[model samples]
Target: IDPRKTETAEIASAHHFIVPGSDAYLLLAMLQLMFERDWVNAGHLAPLLQGVETVRELVAPFTLALAQERTGISAAVIEAMTEKLVQTPRAVFYGRMGVSVQEYGALCQWAIQLINLLAGNVDVVGGALVPNSAAGYVKPGERGAGHFNRFQSRVSGLPEFGGELPATVMAEEMLTPGEGQIRAMLTLAGNPVLSAPSGQQLDQAFEGLDFMVSMDIYINETTRHADYILPPTSALEHDHYDFAFHRLAVRNTARYNEPVFEPEAGALHDWEILNQLSQKLGDHKGIDVKMFPAPSAIVDQSLQQGPYGKHNQRGDDALDLAALREHPHGIDLGPLTPSLPQRLCNEEKNIRLVWQGIADDIERLRIASPPQQQGKLLLIGRRHVRSNNSWMHNSHRLVKGKPRWRCLMNSKDMHEHKLADGDDIVISSRAGEVQTEVEQSDDVMPGVVCLPHGWG
Candidate 1:
């Protein structure tokens, strides 16, 4: 975790790709090397692999020079990182809050997956093991023509996750005049305006929405715009199970925490609210809907339809919540099952890296109108340990030591602009502009700026 630590016994070599804002480009560069050098073990990938040639072709344009330019990373540094991966033991590459919220967020995520796959580090010891939790291994929802393979938003047709796009377009969907424009929004555990793209634009868009509903624990920026705010119980009030991270950890470990206190006031559990809203929306309120059903039902349903469904043909009914809870924390799922040869999505056993449609989208952006050359600063979002999204923003202890939000600038860049640290500055992006106090930090490279989320 320390940047100062040299590549060592536990670590081999560490290289930082100054590819500040975009994680996808950095990943492409690494994948390009794996293909070009034949470092990937083809045999290791069995029936669960799909679309290898497509991936290779997609990454072809992201040569060292191109990536360096696109990501602001030095080619030499990228190459050095590749070298370290080739020489290190248990060398694991990771990225967290940094790449998850960006203009090209999904691409960044995909690229990280590609790097892990090519390096043969997935689900392996000291590698990028899928973290599992006591929530049980229930797969995500199904992917279909209406789902995966298609983009829905007007400006950016980002691929859908769980039958929906990035949720970045929620505000816009309601504002843009159209027949299919969103008339209602149901946000479950998300704050789009603070976490999504085009913050200024989104703010304007929210004002135009007919009905905005928020299911959250606390009232914050985005929720303040809602017509109805449904409060959900805080983490301490509910049983905790991290279903997503369990599959990604090196060693399977599970921890269970019983509710610290009984539900007080009118605060309802998150799952209960989600179920209530879904039934009301689906117009089937009379029938009971188990939002978070038994793990077996979830696993069976997901395996039968989700992206991983086809791969796991003969699933057992034994995998359920009772089974998971039997061990209290969780049962270690062990190493990742094989994936290369068999296609997880396609019937054929191959890897489809290109995702032609995604490639086309990026290509369009490349050729699209360039960002305005105005002096506005590029806006970026950062996360903190205090809360997720805008749920607990009012916590006095959390916001007391820091500005609710910050405008981070490279010291050199600040000096060049003749702007002093702590001075209020107007930041303008193609989306719009906002005023925030500036803070100088050497952590960010010159010419770039960062802003913490949860502040207007």
Candidate 2:
């Protein structure tokens, strides 16, 4: 269910128009009803799950009546949805930016996963399945024990995750004075100016940088500020293989794409540019600058040693990279299989459902309240199929026919404010304000406005 009458929502069994930023409460209430009705998958969950009692106690305060008031979703609807979740043999709760961009985002995400696990849906067919890739990437060790934080950000003191600080602090690090201040930055395929939280703040921060280098395909809003803009070869000119997407695919599949066209003279692939830059910087201890120089060689080696490799001496069921090369279309591996706690559990083969991080955050969620709208419309972002991002706005084919950038306000709201279609309206938030043409539509929920993201 979603707040907006989006294209996806039109075909949904039911569309719930929830109050913005109240996802956590709604989800918690669902879990509460599940527990109260005794509809959980006890047998499957009893063996692999932990912290059930804790979660049950944590969500006790979030009754259906309270949830109805907070989420603007009727108690009957909440109960019906919760009943559907429990009655279904295999179900998964999937949420995107609607749940992520609000307060208690992390809590809502954790709660969704918890609900799926309690329902015996995780790592199973027709449920929340895990992808099995040929590449056996080593899983990072446990946090706070094997992977400890070395330092905190100077400005916000936010602890680093996976040896990297949050991108939201980039502007502060550049503008702040003191030791270890960031004076220069090297960005790769990132448009933080448009994608980041505050575009105005990031624009000022980019202006303040001593030196900046950007590796991008287009001279867009973010790259225009860079002292040196290194454009990489287009996707059509680069040999492509799926690395990250394969690991997240719903079904098992493998595909390789040879360059469709040769790159222009003197143009370098993204990998080559980074390799050459590393050599120039005098760091060549472990890397072989000469060996496996091109992406094709790297792909061959990775596939040869990967799970589908014919050269894999470990098993007879191994696959051959040559077979894949012959089939230029693609190779379908098949549907998701059940690879449960054994394939994904910790070193001791145990799933720790309750963590210190989640436990501490529950207290915060207990007292959490939605931000006061104060008679102002809550602003949210939307995406169009034609526009990939701000960069795609330059494409004549994509931006042709009609304008796609406009503030979408509910018809009731527009009529109440004495505004007409195509009238310019000023939208102001604590971060900043922008004046844009208004489009009156019932697709958006009342007291909320929708604006497409990545627009300059």
The residue-level lDDT of candidate 2 at 255 comes to 82
Best by lDDT: 2
Residue pairs with clashing backbones, model 2: 308-319
* Candidate 1 lDDT score at position 343: 23
Q: Give TM per candidate.
A: 0.73, 0.92
Error of 2 at 329 (Å): 1.5
Question: By TM-score, how accurate is candidate 1?
Answer: 0.73
What is candidate 2's lDDT per residue for 1-456, written digit by digit as tens?
A: 666898989898878888778888889888888889887774454676667888788878888998898888999999988888867877778987789877678788988987887777787677888776654322334234334347899999987866888777888888889998888989998888887877888888888899999999887778888999999998799888787888888988888887899998999989888878887665547654542267666666766666567655746656555666777997887887767655653765556667777777777877766567777888888887778556577678878876687889999999999999999888887778888889998988899898888775
C-alpha lDDT of candidate 2 relative to the true structure:
0.79
The lowest-lDDT stretch of 10 consecutive residues in candidate 1 is 1-10
Superposition error at 290 for model 2 (Å): 10
